[model samples]
Target: MTFAEITTKRGDASDGMATGPLGRAHVRADGPAKITGRATYALEHAVADALHCVIVQSTIGAGRVVSIDKSDAEASPGVHLVLDAGNSLPLVPKADFFGNLPPGDTFVPFATEIRHNGELVAAVVADTVEQARAAADRLHITYEEAPVVATFADPRAGDGNPVEAMSKTWGEAEQALAEAPVSIEVRYETPREYNVPIEPHGLIAHWEADDRLTIHEPSQWIDGMANQFATWFGIPFENVRVVSPYIGGGFGSKGQALPHSAVAATAARMLGRPVKLAVTRPQTFTAHGGRPATWQTLKIGASEDGRIVAIDHRGANETAAAANFVETLGVVTSMMYAVPNFRSRQTIVPVNTVVPGAFRAPGKNPSAFALESAMDELAIALGMDPVELRRRNEPDVDPENGKPWSSRRLLACYDAGAAAFGWSKRNPEPRSMRNGRQLVGWGMAVGTHPVYSSPGEAMVRVLANGRVEVLSSAIDMGTGTYTILAQTAADALGVPVERVEVKLGDSRLPRAPVAGGSQLANLMVGAVHKTALAAREDLIALGLSDPNSPLQNQANTLIIEDGMIGPPRGPAIPLGDLLTATGRDALEVTRDTLPEKERTAEERLSMFTSLAGMERGPGIPKSRHSFCAHFVEVLVDEDFGTVRVSRVVSAVDAGRLYNPKLADSQFKGGIIMGIGMALLEEGITDPRNGRILNANLADYLIATNADIPAIETISVGEPDYDATPLGGKAVGEVAIVGMAAAIANAVHHAAGKRIRDLPITMEKLL
Candidate 1:
């Protein structure tokens, strides 16, 4: 395999020409397939004589299973097998740090002990889906219920220790607060939230003979899934094959291989037949994971001039006793602004509930709401403009580690958003703006998220027909990944975008990281860029070595464009003709963009210095984060306590825009989710037994088209060449970071009510 490396540094003139289809607004290449129903999601795959499986969940939150009666279910019509702890295949415990597993209890299949309600207890396999579901419902199980700590308010919830990595302090914030002229302390609470991607979790497993296994599932990380399946089944990694060409949506929940996947595979091997499992929407709430609820306290101290002098943020979040996943909500404040004295800490609260996982922006979303809303309250105390107060507190460098920013354009975003939003015309007083029996108010907040790059590999092949194929294992979770990769290849090869095809979502292809953390674009694009460059070099070598070539020794003066190779200003020959003359069918090159393992000591130190205060290492001197500003206008009905957002304008400085149309769509989608976070979405749990009360869409609320407002997104400036080859930063998470805060601020401005809790429901307002 040939390798080409791309080191992150200042880009040159060739970078400009390679920006061919980058900024252009192109439609998603996978859109037609999706809308026309040609794309195959996980459960959509059809296999002949496939058995269906339905899992039975425990009714008790905490206890030990005493008795299981499966005779009734096994005797039902079309039933194949009933797998319980006594009959199910033995499985190994999850290894530490595998598939992002926290340091706590591992998920064991068909375990006799129950840690929470809805824990998988048994699996029923039948000839048809209906039979499997019916049989599963017929199974009778009994358990010994134990006293449970089911809520965040329970006295036992605070038994866990603090997360040391997330705790940081610069100076004495208490002293600064005591001496400041103005100070405000506020607490904010957010409810648990679910991912709820359109397509629920599903998987199909087939065992060929006894050593080989194949799975069709929607996973954001196929490579990791393959490794996990291999380890669990005691098979070689090469014998386990995972295929996931198209994922409906993940939002981080589908990134790992859950417990049900193991059950489906185990059942298939036992029966010597293919088995399919489709997790129902209601089951998704407990079977997979969701974001944990958070309680945050923020204290700020400011001078008379509205400049922040001290800040302290602390968060307590609920996690399942089975997993040690703590929401580090306070970390977002470390890079948000400049404060001389700052402190942040995170403490986990263990409760007998479903294990929490990452949802969209993860810790940043809830923390931003707390931090920005507290800033709004502080502005009110100081009698200063909210936007002006934020601008005055913008840090010249990262406040925690005294590191310079790779690219800090948050002020630019604020200026652009304020200008576009017409912020100067707004009245300062709350309840002063009105529209036909409704109160109108405007609010704005800052958004920031970390930028990171992981190792990945890609392969580029130039065929005899002058077509290009770029291959990787990256998943396209309806985020326009396919379209962006196509554009990147087209630009690099100097060919039409349509002539380039991108093949992804298969572990057989070159390896790539999971499509989470907003790192997919940067990683994949860098790999593709290096692969294409290497292929170009191979083509030039082949052309120069052939005596029949147009100009034998003019390689130094040759120009490759539009699939043609020729002298600087002479007759050109098609790449296919040159390949035919050289007796070659196609040319292929592979490149791997590994982490900075091979860099010199100074280079590594410099790289770490840029990522200081992010837990990367010590002695780092700079920080890299994407920034955005969300401005919103809301209409409040004082009579009914109803709040409706009428308009939103989001200005972002996330390096460069890969495709403005798709980027705008991502921004709107994230903002819509933010609106849901602010005014709608909440996952309720019954305190009596620790069961999720709102497990289905009918009970759990999300924003609909009727509830959304007119959203506009703006890009602040040119690319940040220091970020990546494409000069773009991560855009997926930042759009929603500060959205809830902005909406809550607007609500306070209109109604003169400071609702610290999330979902600012009518009941709370009234």
Candidate 2:
């Protein structure tokens, strides 16, 4: 099974047969509308008589509010109401993190107790956004500040608790490390990062009546948001509606409902009017979670022949004092490679900051940095080619649970990427490759992310006019969800791509999993595929039973293609004509894909405990993961010590690609984000006051067009049918997993400088 084989099975219109779109490079359906500014985002929706709301944040990091004087704000012009602890809707306590029980204190916004700086304290609703901002500024508040433990480095920071179920030891790691002939130990640090999507978090909450709440917001998890609001307000779940047709970008930031959304909903209900709140650029840093700061120390031992004998990874990540969200630093460590003995310990260090949440690869990003960099170091110790070292340690079964892999084509990716990037031309010696006062270096590393799928439901309708519509609560988030889903329905229904329509990001539609973890593609596509097949079968049955139909009782030889149904090789009849003959306007079917339904409640809870994938155990006989290899070239200036990634070749094995064009873009996007993590992006927190110094885009750096290099992406491997019915795995996040390490290895090769800390800035090189 290879990419070539996958391409052959892709649907073909040439032979007059209908098949699902599996490996096509179709353009995004939403691109034209988005580029022309005709697409409506969450904040772009219009509502009559909607008041604007602005939030006031706490100045102190940890404290108790002494007093709040809202008199001036109440008297301000156009101020409809000022909501604070003194007067706000009381919310019932619900299980944290979408009802997945965890050991942590649950909290809501508009509290008098300050947990961290920028905590939501009050909100002002007025006739306009400017008036709301003015009133928010006029509110006088005083706080009795307490001492703050800002980060993992703070002396007051606790030793932290071991992450439950995440920390485990297999075999005798210490004994194996001691007996191994070769070994290396290294510590790597990654700084706090924020998900500053193009469109900041915003919401417009409206109460149509006392019991009904409607929110037009950008949400990655529509059903979760509706359920959360329903739980908070003690209303029926059906009464809460979440409508998010389009989003600017999410990158995991919009997966969960933050406190600001709650404040807006509260204000809207209190004022008896609609309230719109757009989180400012700076507030987005603390309003929702991002990638947490991590400290990882890895000890790897190998034989002289480069076979990994032992690996011990111990790490800590910063979480909020008010929440329990630990970065699973051992996510990729336990199963990435073939190590006979493995040990991992993950600790959660509570800091005076916002609770960290998902950011793209989340746990795997930082974990891969440490483990992959350590592998590079081990390769240096063994005097072996990095690619060869990885090939030698490739596992036959999952090292964590001894399960066979559904699909493991990582070596193929390495081969493809290395050949494309001209790896054989490289000189492995550090600082040996030079060109005109600049040093060139080539480096490569393994990339991986787990495959996850939750229950998803979708509705497919084939109209009498020969058009198809697929509806689901899943969102695009600029990931081509609409395009791929439409393609899936069109392929399944034997129709042209142009005749399929996709409607998503609304709770009123069929339910879907959250758009994070790269799981929506598998779940939603499978649901659409099933429902479309059922609809086609229903239509064919109608044609057989209809007395006026041209082809009755030809079930075995019937074929549906190009919106026409007939016996193979003859007498094709239009689908619209059959529907008219049957006295039916359309055929519709709704279906769901529930892969995890057999798991117990406890097992289900463990799946989303920290946004990691399902645990490998006896019930699951196969370990599923998407694999890639990144070959990076970096240039180092002789005088200034600035490093730039000149080019990248990322070869990915994500089962079967539904849309190669979109997959190509997703690969490049993740690589560019990896560049930011390696050389540019860092959230500078003022430890003294627990304030994020670089909160705005001007201060918080990201990879722009000027920083990007030429990126080449190659798709590899066959469809992993064992993992999912669609034969596709997670695609987006794995590209960023090993990127930072590859760039760091390139830096060391170019300048002979090893900087363990993230954002390998010029000062460290100099």
lDDT per prediction? 0.82, 0.84
Best by lDDT: 2
Which segments of candidate 1 are over 4 A away from where they belong?
Answer: 1-19, 96-107, 547-551, 596-621
| TM-score computed on alpha carbons, candidate 1 | 0.94
Error in Å for residue 21 of model 1: 1.9
Question: Residue-wise lDDT of candidate 1 within 85-150, one digit each (tens)?
Answer: 888887655542222453334445775878788888999999998999998888888899988787
Instruction: Candidate 2: list runs displaced more than 4 Å.
Output: 1-20, 98-108, 553-557, 595-618
Clashes of 2: 0
Candidate 2: C-alpha lDDT? 0.84
lDDT of 2 by residue, 469-581 (tens): 89988888889898888878878888767778888988888877678778888878888989999988887777777787778876665778988999887788888888777
